[model samples]
Target: MATIDLTSDAFEKTVTADGIVMVDFWAEWCGPCKAFGPVYEAASEKNPDITFAKIDTEAQQEIAGALEIRSIPTLMIFRDGIQLFSQPGALPGHALDDLIDQVKAIDMDEVRAEIAKQTDEPSDAD
Candidate 1:
């Protein structure tokens, strides 16, 4: 599947949807973002089951700000409404593939449990 462009209006709904979603935050003026665009597109074709979405930082500044994206070509992976991975910098094709594999291999049940435990624990500030 080809990547879909995301705006602030759609960002929440798209990332919160079930299944895996890969969001690429980029800008037209960034060289690395240009280089990584094709790699991201290729991965989308290869992984048809996943949702590949792009947020043009120039056009969607609000969303970028909300996500605290300080760099172009930032990649974020979300699964089952939870963020599993977030990193800045462009990834090569092989690295992107490896990342997809790692995300796929994650045991979400364990992740949920870990989140639950953290939330249940009392905060040091309390």
Candidate 2:
């Protein structure tokens, strides 16, 4: 799939709508984000099953704030509305491809169970 631009309003709906969603948080001024752009776009074409989305932090400050994006070219992945992975830095094409493989290989059932466990556990705030 081609990389789609995401606004704050569309972020939630796109993430929750289907299978895997990968978001690239970026800013036009960042050099690393520029380098990673084609790599991310290529990965999107190679893995058409996944949703590849981009958020321009400069334009979508509200969404970026909500996600607490600390750096440019931060990558986030979500599956079934559950965020699976997030990281900062520019990945080379090979590394990004490897990451895609890893994401595809994950067992969502176990992920869900872990999420439930974490939520069920008492917080220190209590």
Who wins the TM-score comparison?
1
Off by over 4 Å in 1: none
**lDDT of each candidate versus the true structure:** 0.96, 0.94
**Candidate 1 per-residue C-alpha lDDT over 30-118 given as tens digits, one digit per residue, 9 for 90 to 100:** 99999999999999999999999999999999999989999989999999999998999999999999999999999999999999999
* Tens-digit lDDT track of model 2 for 1-126: 499999988889999876999999999999999999999999999999999999999999999999899998999999888888899999999999999899889998999999899999999897
The deviation in Å at residue 119 for candidate 2 is: 2.1
Weakest ten-residue segment in model 1 by summed lDDT: 1-10
Every model's TM-score: 0.96, 0.93
Which stretches of model 2 miss by more than 4 angstroms? Answer: 123-126
